[model samples]
Target: MQETVLFVDDEKSYLAYTTSIFENKGLRILTASSAMEALEIIDQEHVSVVVSDNEMPGMRGLELLAKIKELSPHTVKIMMTGSADLSTALAAINSGEVFRFVVKPWKKSEMLRAVKDGIRRHRILQSLAREDEYILHSLAQTIELKDASTRGHCDRVATLALKIAAELHISVDRQREIKYGSWLHDCGKIGVPEAILNAERALTPKEFDVIKKHTIWGCDVVRKANLSKTVQDIVLYHHERWDGKGYPCGLKGEDTPLEAQIVAVADVCDALTMDRPYRKGLCRDEFLRTIVEMQGTNLAPHLVDTLLQILERD
Candidate 1:
């Protein structure tokens, strides 16, 4: 998506020249005369690679790069400086912020090569992210096989959560996190015993306590896998309730991340509508009434409302 490269420099002439040099190289070019302006572009646009001149009016290139890292950690950052001091290069490297450091009055070939390398690195990261997503989906399916009753539960929850996220106008990156998190939300069930999961009888208090540990277990699994913080939160907090009475952490209301909240609604809806070992599945009208009754207590009111609208539409 970041087929665009952003050039940041105080010198308008320099930005124009850089754009001209790269215009025909099959790259979309974006420019800004100040770091603040560049930040605006970065926020508003999908910038794959950023090349910034070190000495800008307000914010230095290194400082701008740091902010950009927070805003879009995957965007490749390249620093250019005419001074090209040893300390500056060391600082950029030490901060782990720069993909490439170029001396000012750059050769055309050298600059082109660095930009190409940055683009290549960005594409590699994108590919790796896709692979990670595939692995997460497979893991979810494997976890489902542990309990026959919940065979397609993860996929259903993911589909419903994604629809809710889209209706809420969540960003694409966050939507991806929601999808991954939904699939992996129940992964901690792997730690539970088969007899307990498959038991047709209602769980005793002690057994229910064991069930609560699944959230923490899921969080541990996600942590060891080095997943994103959003995914970890979902794995741990998807059981949290709006009224602060839920399990594992009992996080209440907005304290739970919005993504987790969205997944929670999906989980509840799916569980209510699907047959469990002990109970019959609810019909569509009953499921809708149950979801509406949960608003402001068991579920986030806005999310419950969004889910109801989605159900009605479908």
Candidate 2:
């Protein structure tokens, strides 16, 4: 489908002129006479760009731009106004989050150029978001590979967390976040020394302290890398316990992000059921019983029940 652009202006002549210009360029254009009408059009259309005149009767152009930012944050916004005053430009920049500002009596070529640049910037933002997610997943895998015993642990935990998310009927976007969070849940371990990580025996007090630093380290790494806040929180707090006795920050109970808590239960269940260098894997019955016994104490009660139901059906 062709990318759609929405042009909003109280002036019918200007709307007609700009719509014709963009249409000739093989772009799909939707027009609205007022900000309210424009919002309605936006709700019904997949608008990639919004060009709005600043001097409308009901809602001024700057106010319309602010509303657009709230309604469709990803849509590129361009403000067109007769006034080139400092205040108008500042409002467009600060409040409207305008991608470009066009003065009234804009040359057709100038208008076209601004639209093209807005589209390019939107695409660049999208590409950067994808690249950020890729880097996060790569870092997660690297941390998983640090210990031979947990080579596929991240993958398994992510898969299990996604299943639980489905059972809970989470939104598709939230489920995706949970899945990514699960993959990178243990990334803080990258900060722990290899000697402490790979040690076969129970960890010494100092070594354990070093291991615990991984959670803080992981949060710092993500914060520095500018990962999404939700993913960063999950990585930092996945080690927290339901009873409040666990981990680098010792966050407990409902203080943990729900996604992190779900992953924590899945992570522990998988770790217990799968073979580890220190011990043989538990039998299926024992594994199920162990989780059931810990419900409401170690695991979130609802998630524990969901996990057990999954295992039962399988």
In terms of lDDT, which candidate is strongest? 1
Query: Model 1 residue 40 lDDT?
Result: 81
Write candidate 1's Cα lDDT for 187-299 as tens digits. Answer: 99999998889999999999988889999999999989977788899999999999999977888889999989999999999999999998989998898888889999999
Backbone clashes, candidate 2: 0
Question: What tens-digit string does per-residue lDDT give for candidate 2 at 169-248?
Answer: 66454565677778887888877887777777788998888877777887787778755666777888888888888886
For each candidate in turn, the TM-score is 0.83, 0.67
The whole-model lDDT of each prediction reads: 0.88, 0.80
RMSD of every candidate to native, in Å, equals 3.4, 6.0
Q: Please, what's the RMSD in Å of model 2?
A: 6.0
Candidate 1: residue 248 Cα off by (Å): 2.4
